[model samples]
Target: MDTLTCHPCPLDAAELARAGRDDPATGALGEELAARHLVADGCDLVARNWRLYAGELRGELDLIGVDTAEGCVVVCEVKARRDASRFGGALSAVPPRKAAKIRALTAAFLREARLPYPRVRLDVIAVDLGRDPVLHHVLAAL
Candidate 1:
């Protein structure tokens, strides 16, 4: 298991909008913030927005990183929302079905990448872009 640290850095909606003309939503910003948070926690990120399609089964992993201390592959799913009040926060958005799909995708990633890690963990990084923007990390969520 890996320990997580919370940082206080609120994202500026106006700045983000100006920065990326392509993405109108805050999802891209959230993913970037999550990736930075992981690196700050001593995790070496291997891939971002990794998509795998094994026949009819297709899934996309938000972030994939290696925990340097634990020597395990961490598969992260990031959910970003401007207001979490509607959906009970970004963390709660990932239901059982979504979690199962993430697990399946992780397996496919391992098979394709042939990563030699002893352990693989599923994680979720929820980014709240509300009044108090927060980046919450749930380790070994699945």
Candidate 2:
């Protein structure tokens, strides 16, 4: 596994915390952190921000990697927040609807990329960039 970081993040941690949810810098840093964390946990990265277009629908997968230990493909969704406590934390953001979409995206990815694996798992990484940066990882979340 290789280390990944937000190389082009224009905003510092403090600035990122102050920015809105759609701020690209904050999202990038969050994804980078999640990627590095997954790598440390023994995932071989496949792609980041992988977008797929099938017919009229388009879906973007935040992180797609292989969990070497499990011998399976791992699909990760990353959610970041400055104050997680305010909105029931980041995990709550991924509701059933989002999970369903992720499942659809996984099928599309496997078909389009012709990727094969013994199993496929859905995971979630929640990053809180408040007083201290905290990461919450949920394995096989969906």
Candidate 3:
């Protein structure tokens, strides 16, 4: 497995540890770590922080990964917390502003990347940073 260190994060790990319930900093490193995890699981990563299209209607997809599974492009939004208690509040953490952007961004990514796929899935990998980093992946969003 290949591991890449994300140095000089705008917010330090210590800062993420004490992030508020709905704070964006909650286990922020999990995105990079989770991206690695997905790659290790055999997903072909096409883009990281894919900012496709523009203007009042644009999107910023976090990760765009591909695999043979259903010929799908997986759009992953990662959320991580310190422990199990942080679970219930974790999924609620991805603010509408960010989520909306991601939703639009993924669309632009697909449109611009010209990814030919019969199936596209949006997923959220929520991790509770407990003993082993709990991951709750949501297949679809409402």
Candidate 4:
């Protein structure tokens, strides 16, 4: 079994945000927090930022984890915003169209990797970058 471990360089969200001038720092921080949250929930990290492209179609899964307790591959979509009021939080970001793409991407990932199609489920990790970061996880979200 191939797995990836996260070794996050010690940095606070503000520092990270400053470093990521082009993109919001909360994105990286949120993924890191989500990964840790998954581990705490008894899931093993399979991959992070796993990307695949076929022809003009390209997709990226923020975090892929195996929930050993549930015996399912957890394909997580991460959404981060500076505040919940910005766009109705992370969950709102994943519209029907995005969810459909994630579903298709999950299948493609399994086929391209030549891995058995385990019972797969989609999850969403919503990160609210307030004064203190808060994460809201919705399992089988889509």
Q: Cα miss at 39, model 4 (Å)?
A: 0.9
Give the per-residue lDDT digits (tens) of candidate 4, residues 51-107: 986666688999988877777888999887666775586658989899888988888
TM-scores of the candidates are 0.85, 0.80, 0.66, 0.79
Evaluated against the true structure, the overall lDDT of model 2 is 0.76
- Among all windows of 10 consecutive residues in model 4, the one with the lowest summed lDDT is 1-10
Q: Which candidate wins on lDDT?
A: 1
lDDT score, residue 102, model 4? Answer: 92
Candidate rank order under TM-score: 1, 2, 4, 3
Best by TM-score: 1
lDDT, candidates in the order shown: 0.80, 0.76, 0.65, 0.73
- Per-residue lDDT tens digits for candidate 1, residues 41-116, read 8889999989976597897999999996988999999887777776577778889899999998988888888878
Ranking by lDDT: 1, 2, 4, 3
**Which pairs of residues have clashing backbones in candidate 4?**
none
Off by over 4 Å in 2: 1-22
Displacement of residue 126 (Cα, Å) in model 3 is 0.6
RMSD of 1: 3.0
